[model samples]
Target: MNDIAKHPLAMDGKDPSNLRGDPIDPERYYSRSFMEKEWQQLWTRIWHIAGREQQLAEPGDFIVHDFMKESVIVVKQTDGSLKGFYNVCIHRSQRLVWQDNSQKSFACPYHGWVWGLDGVLEDCPDRGDFPQGDPVGKLKLSKVRVQTWGGMVWYTMDDEGPDLLTYLAPTAELYKNHQFERTVRVNWLRVALNTNWKFWSDNFNESYHTRTVHPQVPPIIDQDHFTSRYEMFPMGHNRIIQMGRPSLRDRLPDGVPHPFDDALRAWDIDPDSYPDFETKAMQGWLDLKAAKKKLWKEKGFLHYEHLDDEELTESPFQVLFPNVAIAPGADSFLVWRWEPHPTDPEKCYFDQWTMAYPIEGQAEFVNRTAVNPLRLVEAELDFREYDNGAGVQEYSDQVVFQDWQLTAGQTAGWRSRGYRDPYFAAQETRVRRFHEVLNDYIAGNPPGR
Candidate 1:
């Protein structure tokens, strides 16, 4: 593994000294009171991804991000800037926008109050009938703090919360090389799962279950803990940088076609040239990095120019505090965001977005997890329920589907009397650290203010 100490802002996430060793209580996952506390303290205070900035390209284009019982609207202004507001009419608290679309102005269905693109009250009926002053040009929609980062529009309900960049900190700085804004969202899917939102937070913070749950991942993106670098930032985000090559310990049966071999051959390297599996896994990985660095520009991989050798060949899976997990690669970016259900602590919505940079000749992008060949375009929203694996039957082969299948069982396990505090491995320190951070938020003290 590379020397993580050489990188700025990189802390040993696997080190127990970085954490408080807080017991991950079971109630945090399934209790109604704890869910309410999280809704008030954590979810509302943290920066939330409303939608991709690409969704709001033109003026007056907006996307409504409904979280729990609250809805927020992120819209593009006439001045070529983005603004966010609570998706409620100022007069009667009626929801102004029901879905994402472009419009000249927001009109309340209940009261006929028209709000302009700038969020000001443009017009209202019966101007002289109100006891107060004229509603037009005086009343404005309530605003939320909005910011853009990594091609996504983010808004926070808390006025005193940290700024987006400050909250993101080294994470935003680490990904400054990749032009995430230029990538197209090839897949936008939401799956309703019967599990707490914390299930995703815990699942993503550790890769210990990858070998058992996502067996296909080890062969493609080395899941060996010793080979990966674990980094936890003070800003409540954690990242695991895994080698993009196959794990030396995980070898497919002899004569089986290897995905790593195909990856090497795609970059003009011969996988068979290596004498053994270990050599092929290790040396082939180095060769792939060299191949990418040497031929990136000629092969139309323009996004790789600013990336370092490690960034070009490694998979950095980042878990932004609480809900968002992003796996950014040289060519493709996979993002997963989990949100709590409106009324059920045992149910949550999960979003998976596959984004890829447009190559000169490549017309489609195949995501590693889903393996779905998607066209290079902004896809429409797709919502599904994990109805015993029937609703999204096509996604049954996905890594997330495997995880979804375990959610119900895990949720039941959490509520079991036999359940006890998690006995975490050193590599799984981030899982406990995530809970400690949640404790911080619940105790009215979150990191970065």
Candidate 2:
């Protein structure tokens, strides 16, 4: 039995009739004019993730999120609330802060103008020289709307747009079982990719490409489309939940060691207890869930207490509107965000944050997407330019690294003169639905108005 919710506000994501039959124009991927449309029509209207709630534990802690050409600072207020401000100083538009740090007040380096944690201008260097009547308490930074959910800090430029939870819809409600607040991010990485930002939006909308692009995943995540569940929310977000078992059609060779066995072993289930491979793949999955339910608390996985049977062993990937995709698995969570470049439409930045729950006495975890063992602690950000695969050499074994290798070729493919509208598979219905929603936003008729 699957745990896919038929939300009242969501459409049948597997049905192509739900889409507008919109042609995904190639220009939308790499044209400057199209990029300008996204900036004016979509970017300003959507809620953006600045950072995490854990980063703002103190009253004055702040995260400076620099997106394309715009900069924003989400600060923790003295009253224990969160507020966001455009990072530009009210005077001369100088940048207020360039990094994430804790401070009682922000002093602009341009003219030593001091701004309080609440965004009020506390002091100006030249008190008497201002022609606009000293401009201290009366002047303040421009405010942006800020909210938090799922341990993530969110902000929006459109002051009147829907709240974060409303924008997230059933997607937010579906993931209530996860204690993301207690999870520690082990890998904070950003890579400058050569492909457009929409690449990730499309790439994550379907499991069709996973068998080809990420071969190793089929054995662990059950990449068969028929076995997966797809959902499309009215707010432009999408979700796909695949069972935590090996795909029968994509089985390994006889001598090859299976990843599913390792997963079963981790939960105290004997892999060799099954008589056959098919029984091990099907019956073993149910047994694995039962084993986890029986051993979670004593095994130090307190977060599993509230999780349902499906939540304890399923792989649910959520695509949040236009740019963010997240996998809130039982043991690990991954947030994948991609944004356009400052000036070039052919390039984008990809952020990968790997978070794992803290199990008592467990210092390390098996990060399926990473090469190294992930420790249960927060990690500092590591930024790199792809440089045609020369950079991030240490992440060669990571699944995302394999995806990164396709950017150079995919960029060239998009600009091909022979390019035409894509003919998608049934499993890829959400890909077309994604572009249809983009059409809605660009047409000023976004869903969930």
Candidate 3:
């Protein structure tokens, strides 16, 4: 057989590929030190998306997120600015906020010490009788670094990590002309799973698993035209290659509204309401053209092209390494950030947020326009469960539940004596590139460039 048939993703001078080989070493994964390093060195330093600006809409609104073992409280100040802090009370390390919502201020159930929305100490139980003479003035809730990007809240434990924009890099530009600041509906979580954080990310970085793991995703995306590319950024950050489906230029369903073309007519879309509709719609048109070219190259038929280019590019999926994955569709975008749990080897939190463009001008239509990418469309076949030689977990629920069992199963197998390192194929470049960065970080390579 030819080399292409024999070795998919073959590279020169590297060790033999690890395609369909032994599993990765479980010991490296289960090592206490590895987990601890992740907590101290990685988790604390990395910028992780916690929630969106809409979640902290009101001045006193706050959202409490449990990151690893760290409790993060994202609160909107009276000035309409947002701040993030460790949810622990400055006094006795007690949790300051139990739930997420608008409150005048955060009060510690432990000692009744309260902090303002800005995370400043604002009240104490009794100041006159204290032996330390009012420790309140000296103590304020410890603040964590926070920044908002693409209308989402992101934080880091280290005050010295890269700036939020710098950290997100080229990925941040993905939604540049889409008016993302106005689209802020999302659901996020910081799951605690025993498996390595990389496991979930690796699974997301490659589309090869889609056909088997996410049966529906494959039909939505053109797999035969698939190609995976990688770009390394400074500070050990990376972006992976995920192109639009070849069928994107295909004709839309008959009689559907041509939002892009309609805007150019005498009935112009209101700029105030549409914001960046022109740019976004133009992008959709261009994407549709790219999609049509892709389909014609691989498939011998002409697909519908009524939609704009922006619609074309916005519907595909891509991954931004270390944490975020973007799965965009016609109706909405699914954004996920994976966080390592504080104290569990068997657990990590997966925070997923969904963003949809609000149908402009019509207030009532806004709510109706909000879309969720993961919501199961009733018409499709849902083989929601997978058997990995273990008892099943749930029935036709969602692809996520399906992956939960497999990821957890892989975590369990990591400890097996027969387990060995995986040999990756060239087609699995994204996975291998991810591991390269992961190993480099673990090995204490000098950062920058």
Candidate 4:
């Protein structure tokens, strides 16, 4: 009910007619040939998220994102701009850095050929010995295109593809109220899952599985398809604007303490005053919005000032084409990046970054999907193996943990001879759209070309 005006470029995401009725091909999930094709056609042509812009706050600070078999170094330059290059030394093609850190110049650990933060060769041990006389001051590391949006530093391997904003299209203009650059990431995590990377792409595109998988979420986030607005953009991006209120039908049992009540009381609305559960959910949701609009100034929620009624209390989860998912909510901005494993087609990596806007006096943030409340401070990256859910035991309470647990089953299912095309729900239309757009990319005619 609170959805804002839809952007002109948005397609009806709930309509399956927009898709080409592509089968959710099983071979694409397990075949090496399919994986190589993705690398050549899809992964090479699209933009990728390296890290948050805040990570490179000062000049010389750099972050290295290694995707599949390629690694790229993104550096904050002395001119206050960002630059990216293949993480390879010009001399002998040696890898320069393995991790992120600040450095005035990159010294090739293999042979000590020094290159400046600007990627220009500054020195070499045997300058006179080189037959290519005086390579220093002239030779430069190969550059990758770099850009920033919604607090993320993104780079594309393709030199000729669309710009970041153009690729992001109406999505950039849709959430202009959100000053995502102001948010602070409290959790930075990377986990290796033994499932095709597209599992996440298909999983996040619809909420049809939420009721069965995440039973606790229905009462709080409204899991019903009718109440949500699903939108797919022309550039293959998509969004689902779920009402922030509870599902009126998916009620908790009587005598069970409801989670929705807690939100009502926090917003100073008396949840007990409502005569019935439906009124409390339906009416209290509206009341909660009004209370927030009135109390936000004094309540330290300065981020709410420019947000619309929908943005103030709604959930809009976005999938940025091939791999990135971002939830730019009123209170938090969550990002999930799914990448294929280096060698294993059945393995993939998922990055979950929980970011929260800092309120004036609020020191700790309670993100709904995080395992626990986190202090409003930047957290260093924690990389771990899924190890069949053993390595990620600390994140057991996280909702993504449930999805991680299904990796083994899903991985085996993809390889089964009995595996056939999926019977998709209408709400899962974007899932089909994702694969069709991917098919277009492989055919050398990507959407919005």
lDDT against the true structure, per candidate, is 0.89, 0.89, 0.56, 0.90
- TM-score for candidate 3: 0.70
Q: What is the lDDT of residue 154 in candidate 1?
A: 94
Worst 10 residues of 2 by lDDT: 1-10
Write one digit per residue (lDDT tens) for candidate 4, span 308-333: 88888788888988998989988999
- Model 4 residue 296 distance off true place after TM-score fit, in angstroms: 0.6
User: Candidate 2 lDDT (Cα, whole model)?
Assistant: 0.89
Clashing residue pairs in candidate 4, if any? none
In angstroms, give how far residue 256 of model 3 lies from its true place.
Answer: 22
Off by over 4 Å in 4: 1-3
Worst lDDT 10-window in candidate 3: 1-10
| TM-score winner, 3 or 4 | 4
Cα lDDT of candidate 1 equals 0.89
Please give the TM-score that candidate 1 achieves against the real structure.
0.98
